[model samples]
Target: MKHQHCRKAGNVLMIVGLVVMVSSIIFSVLNQLPSIQMPALLAQGAILGIFIGALLWLAGARVSGRERIEDRYFWHRHYDERCRRTPHH
Candidate 1:
């Protein structure tokens, strides 16, 4: 039960991270007033937001195990008895 809860939380965290990253990029691009100090600050903040979002995504992936890579060629599950035996021509 706890693992399920953790997984849900982790997934939510990942979504939040994505939102942060996207918003940062959008705002940074939209703020074209290079002469203003606030725009400069926003540009800097965009960088920080990207970094923070990446960290959050990593943490969430670790907790959720949803990002883990898998080898498609291998499966350890037991096969049917007929599959275990040699095929007869």
Candidate 2:
């Protein structure tokens, strides 16, 4: 799949997960009854959203045509050089 598609799917999954989690919270609150399952459901939704979102975002970043300076070891070397050149108090 294309990077754009992956990114879009990730966004959708994240949004759906957030909605599910929020709804679960509201359901539990409005019911005024503490249920063990509610906590489990909320945790699942949040974890799923964050995990999938991170995966997709990473995929998009990896496949994108642009080069990332952060991804290069040379960048780190240059970073140290630049830091050395800067005045420190």
Candidate 3:
């Protein structure tokens, strides 16, 4: 389903974001010299990755449909009532 695909893509984005963040941290720590400046893009990568990943994940969840407890309960109640109203087929 489209929802499943979106969810999977979102999960991949999140994982990629985490990897970027970790790598940036490691790179910065390894080059912590008084005379050196960290690469601007390296820092940006972590931020962009995390922000974009979270957004994508949220979008995917929206597309996938809400899974709230109240929603489930309401749906169940509606289904039961509908079933009761229908004549046996």
Candidate 4:
């Protein structure tokens, strides 16, 4: 009961946060389109990077069969087997 409610709240927050972050980036890019073009590009890039970070943060919150899918994706293990094979030296 309480645990389930917490989980639901967490999910909602994660989704909302991701959406807000991405929308902010979109707005920044659009706003910077005209004047101050060079600075705008830099701002757009920063915003996009932050947006990606936020999405990754949200992805980290997801559970998959008791494990987080981000564990594989963030580590690049699912796509790059060599990374998994190499020792953490």
Candidate 5:
């Protein structure tokens, strides 16, 4: 079957990576308690994963979705507007 959303497999992979990263952040933060040391190395790894996800998200946002370039452009306009409203570094 063909994907109606992302055009490439790489884009899907990026989305999955992004999900894992976000979930990791949520897990780490929610697990943060007096007893949970959450070793510095692991915390750093989570941060790195989050960073990787953000980058992949950016890439997928830049290059994925839709069949025609026009459709991509339309979605991109929406994405750009959303990004503008969001706080970003």
Candidate 6:
């Protein structure tokens, strides 16, 4: 269904965002080393990647339906707990 597709796309975006962000940070750190002497383009690219990754992550979080599912689980558990505590006549 369309819902499943959206969820899948969100998951992919989240994964790619995380990967890009982490890799960019690692490369940026490597660029700081004396022996590496990385080009200025690397620094610019890393910054750009980090920004894009953050946007993708935020977008994915918004698109994903996980929060609703978690809310459902939370309410179900709460109701169950409250019911168990009250003795039925």
Query: Which residue pairs show collisions in model 2?
Result: none
- Say which candidate scores most in lDDT: 6
Stretches of candidate 6 exceeding 4 Å from the true structure: 67-89
For candidate 2, give the lDDT of residue 48: 64
Instruction: Determine which window of 10 residues in candidate 6 has minimal summed lDDT.
Output: 80-89
TM-score: which candidate is best? 6
Q: What is candidate 5's local distance difference test score?
A: 0.68
Ranking by lDDT: 6, 1, 5, 4, 3, 2
Candidate 1 Cα outliers beyond 4 Å, as residue runs: 33-37, 70-89
TM-score of each: 0.65, 0.39, 0.41, 0.45, 0.53, 0.69
Output the lDDT of residue 63, model 1. 78
Q: For all the candidates, what are their Cα RMSDs to the real structure?
A: 7.9, 6.7, 10.4, 7.1, 8.0, 5.9
| True lDDT of residue 89, candidate 1 | 47
lDDT of 6 by residue, 11-70 (tens): 888898999999899888898889988899988899888988988887776677766777
Candidate 1 lDDT, 1-89, residue by residue in tens = 48898899889889989988888877776666565445567789997998888888878887787665422112212334433445434
lDDT of 2 by residue, 1-89 (tens): 88787557656655565565566565545445554345666656655655555554554454553237355656555555664556445
lDDT of 1: 0.73
Whole-model alpha-carbon lDDT for candidate 6: 0.82
Decoy 3 TM-score against native: 0.41
- Give one digit per residue, the lDDT tens place, for model 5 in 44-70: 777787878877766665556523566
Name the TM-score of candidate 6.
0.69
Please tell me which model should have the higher lDDT, number 3 or number 5: 5
Q: What local lDDT does model 4 show for residue 42?
A: 62
Once fitted onto the true fold, the runs of candidate 5 whose alpha carbons sit more than 4 angstroms away are: 1-6, 65-89
lDDT (0 to 1) per candidate: 0.73, 0.56, 0.60, 0.61, 0.68, 0.82
Show model 4 residue runs off by greater than 4 Å. 35-84
Q: What is candidate 6's CA lDDT for residue 62? A: 63
